[model samples]
Each structure stands twice: as structure tokens, then as C-alpha cells.
Target: MSGLPAYSLPCQSERATLVSALLLLLSWLATPALAQDLGTNGPTYAIAEPHLLRDLQHRLQAKQASGELDTLMARSRERAIASVRDPQPIEGVAATRTPRTFYYDPTFTLDRNVLDAQGQLLFAAGTRLNPLDVVSLSSHLLFFDGRDSRQRDQARRLIAHYEGRVKPILVAGAYLDLMQAWRRPVYFDQHGRLTRQFGVTQVPALVSQDGARLRIDELETTQ
Candidate 1:
């Protein structure tokens, strides 16, 4: 009863048009279908068909015998591992030459309405919202190129200085290798999404939540 309001009744002319449409539809449904007898159109033959699955299975078997399937599988696995081990570096980001500090306001505009379980609108479309209002950063993000030895050392120093309250995010080089060596989670920007979002353009940068804003410190690493 509380779902939606009832629609208003149609006018006299609308009612008459609706009745005429209904009558025509009923007449069409009640009438039987007609077909003209057109015999001897083409020559008939017995069904002779090959099973699709069987053909596919035979092709697979041939591929397996020739070791082509294994080679393809190996190549696919290698490509997957290579992508994870060494992803494309974040563009327009590099080592910090000069120590600079800036703040980023984490305000974003919603493109679509956010709804709850009951379909009630929580936030309307085009509403500008600051994410810091909802949740604060758990820890400081330390972005450094893993390929550079000095930057890697700088990241280690930062992690120790922050007492493990800093996340090491790699913008370049193998993240899996670092994860294995560090014995903790080493995150990669994965196509520069995080760097782009944070507007980070330099390495040895520390991102920490400063009240309602994010404070980014791009520090130069010591030799």
C-alpha cells in the first residue's frame, strides 16, 4: 500500500480508444491462423550432422599431442607472472629533487545517486562529498620508486621512522620481489591510479591525513 500512489483514471475519449484497441486485440487472438499449402518446394535428405563438442575434443587432443597447448599455457602463465612482478611504472612521477610540501583536499563530486538497501537515496547525484568526513587515512602512504636503490633505502628508513605506520607503495619495479624481501605487503600503484588520485609527482613522498585534508611531503632522499 505504501509503494507508490495510484494512477488517475483515463478520460472518456481515452477510455473509448482503449476499448477499441482491446476489441481489436481480442478479435486477432480469437481468429485462427491461416496457411496456404505449398508442397514440393525442395528435395529432402536424411540428417547427417557432426557433434560440435566431439570436434572440439578431437582438436584439443591433437593440440595436446603436439605440445602446443602446453606451450600456450606456459606463455600465458609467464605473461601473468611478469605483469604482477613488474607492472608499468606510473608516468609523470619521479625522484624528489627538492623537498616540497603541499596539501590535497579529498573532495569529489558524485556522478550517480548513492542508495541504501531500501532504495532510499543516501546521497543525491552531483553532490560534492569529502571522503575525509566519512573515514580518515589508516596510515601514511610512502610512494617511492622501487627500482632506485636510494629510494628503496629511503622507504625503509621512512617505515622505521613511522614505526610501521607507513605503507610502501611502489611506482616502478617488481612489487612481488619487495613483498618477499620485506615480509609484508608491498603495494603497487597499478597503472598510476593512486598516484594520479593523490596528485603525487615525486618519490619519497609521504601522504598523511591532516584533519580534513591530506598533507603530502615530497622529501629528497639522502645519498
Candidate 2:
């Protein structure tokens, strides 16, 4: 009150705090720089290792010089050919050891609106439909393992019995070789898609249209 005008005087506590902060700031500014450089505790050396890309390139060069790269490439090419010629057999699907017959209803409900090329809604969402109503299975599907002679023979017999109305579909083994041998378009069920769709879990299975539903007959054959 005595030092400052009554209107200019703020609270004593706030004024003291402000003065203290200014003093602390001045003290800090008056103090010398305190940054210390504690040198490395252990020995240090320049990086001797090559860059990752350079190292990889060197290793690749070494492999190429040894003809290892060529071998790896050839092996990769063989694997690729093998995969296309004979894809990995579907797991849990074995040669028909147990005879079983089942039916699959091809009816499905639309989860979303199906549109035509013009973006016009062809079928609204939640609509139930059967594919058989529009187009029936043109040929009966004969699913079997081409690797087994018995199954191949069975497929051939079935194809002949069906009067060449059967489409030989392979669950495993070389499809191209079978196609050439059978002189027809031998289809391979890539990843057992058709089998899973039809609920077929075994080989030597015959799939035929039984009206609106598909009849799957998993037959047992001798070794």
C-alpha cells in the first residue's frame, strides 16, 4: 500500500510469487551453462559392416557365381509347374473308403443388392433364389483323385455310363495329364471349392442334379 498505488496493488501473495519467479529467472540467466559431455563409457569404432542391400547383393553374387542361384530358380520353376499341374490335395478329402449319399440345396439368400451392368437393381437384398431355376447343371460332376488308378478307372466308367454327360473334376493329381488322356476338359476343383460348396468331403464323388437339389454320392472303391 505504501510502495504501490492502491489501484495498482494486487494481492500480496500474488505479487510475492511474481517477484520470486522473476528472481528465479534472473538467477537462471546469470548461471553458467551446465551441459556436460560424459564421453562414451566403452570403446567405439566406425561402422565396418556393409549396408543391408549391399550385403544382400554380395551374397546374391556369391550364390550366382556358385550356380546356387540357378539351382534355386530351377527348383522354384519346378514347384510352380508342379503347383499348376498338380495342386496340393485337399485336406481331409481321401479316397472314398465309406459309401455315402447326400444332397445339396443350391438355394441362397442375397445379402446385398445384385445390380446389372447398367447399375439397375436386378435382385433386391434379402431376396431368396435358386440357381437351378435359371440354369441347371449341364453335366454331372465326377470328383475323384486322378493319382489313384482305381478312382481314375471309376471316373472313366462313370463318364461312359453317363454317356459322356459327366464332367470329370479332379480333387487332386495332374488334371492336364488326365485331360490329355481322357481327351476332354478334365476340371480340377481348385482348393476343393466345388466339393466344399456341395459338402463333399471325400473322393470318387458323383454330383448330379436331382431336380432343384444336387445329389452327391461318395462311393467306396477297392484299392
Candidate 3:
């Protein structure tokens, strides 16, 4: 009260209330703008401008012309071919079989008889022959991955050694053109039936009959 001037309490209170309302309104309006800037809805992306697209196309053309992609493909093919050729062999595995023995009367009446052109009885019906006298037909079935060059060469050499008596079974390759070009009778595994039957785990394998069972040899190929 000595030399200072003071506002009324009502006036002061009104000014403070007005300032608080202005701050709240400003904050509410700024919330949405800040959210948009921070990309809360999702990232705001700019499309590649015309010049940028042209630049990318030009770079792609340059790479193709430099044969970089071709070189990579060739290397990939070579690695795949090498992997097929040099397969690891499993040890101490042999073809398994179930043995069954049955006996029947040696004498039986024939339901019908078969005769040859010369009126000779070729086989009489119900004629039982001795099992010991039966001969089992056996052959060599060579398994190979025909995609690899080394395996194919090894197969060719083996076929020549066996005088083409080896039956070529392709386990994991489909090169019909190459088969035709090489003039080889190549057969497919057809859902891996032969591989399972002979217990073959590797490529360039040789399956042959050994007495009553089969012997599987997984061959290693050189470069």
C-alpha cells in the first residue's frame, strides 16, 4: 500500500484461468499433428520418382550386360554338380530279406496241363519242383545322379566294363536330353522305391546280387 499498485483478486483469477485454457487448447491441437509427423498410423512412404525408376532400370541393364548374374549361376551349377558327384558312402549296411520255408506233398493231381506246339507237355499243372533246383535270376543295377558330369563319366566307364549289362537307374536327376544324347537306357527311381529296397544312401552306387542277398557299393568319383 506504500508505493505499489495491485490488481483485484477477481481480475487476477480471471487472467490465470484464461491462460490455462489457452495452453490446454494448444496441447490438444498439437497432439494429432505430432502423431501424423511421427507416423503412428503407418509409415508414410514416397513413391520412386520417374528419375529414380529410370536410374534403377539403367543399373539393372548394366549388371546384366556385365554377365555378373550369369557368372553366379554358373558357379551355383558347378557346386551343385560337384555335390552330386562326391557322395559319402554308408558302411556296414546290406540288403535285408525275410526268409520263409514251406513244405508240401511232392505228388498232386493236375487241374489242367499245358502242351507245346509239338504236343510235348511243357509244364504239368500242380507239378511241384524242388526249390533247391530253382535258379534265381540276378543282375547289376547301377544307381547314379545323372546331373553330374563326373558321375556320368564313371557310369559310362562302368557300363563299358560290364559291357552295358548294368542297368542305369537315375536317383536324383532329370536330364532326358542328355540321356538321349548319350544313347543310354536310363531309368528313374520312381519315388525312391529302388533306393529303399537296396538300402542305397549315396549316388553312383552299384547294386549286385551276392549269393542270396544284394551287395551295394557306393563309389567315389574323381574330378
Best by TM-score: 2
- Candidate 3 residue lDDT tens string, 17-96: 44544443344345664333543476668875678545545644554578654454466568777655433323332222
| Clash counts for the predictions, in order | 0, 0, 0
Span of 10 residues, lowest total lDDT, candidate 2 = 20-29
Q: What is each predicted model's overall lDDT from 0 to 1? A: 0.84, 0.82, 0.61
Instruction: Report how far off residue 138 is in candidate 1 (Å).
Output: 2.3
Candidates, ranked, TM-score: 2, 1, 3
**What are the C-alpha RMSDs, in order, of all predicted structures?**
19.4, 23.4, 27.9
Best-fitting candidate, measured by lDDT? Answer: 1
Weakest 10 consecutive residues of candidate 1 by summed lDDT: 20-29
Query: Please, what are the lDDT tens digits per residue for candidate 1 over residues 1-223?
Result: 8899899999999687545444443443468989888886789888888796665556556666887655655665698889888998889998888789999998999999999999999999999999899998998999999999999888888889989999999999999999999998899988888889888898879999999999999988877
Give a tens-digit lDDT track for model 2, residues 153-190: 88888889889999998888999998898789998888
TM-score of each: 0.67, 0.73, 0.40
Q: What's model 2's TM-score? A: 0.73
In candidate 1 the C-alpha lDDT for residue 88 amounts to 86
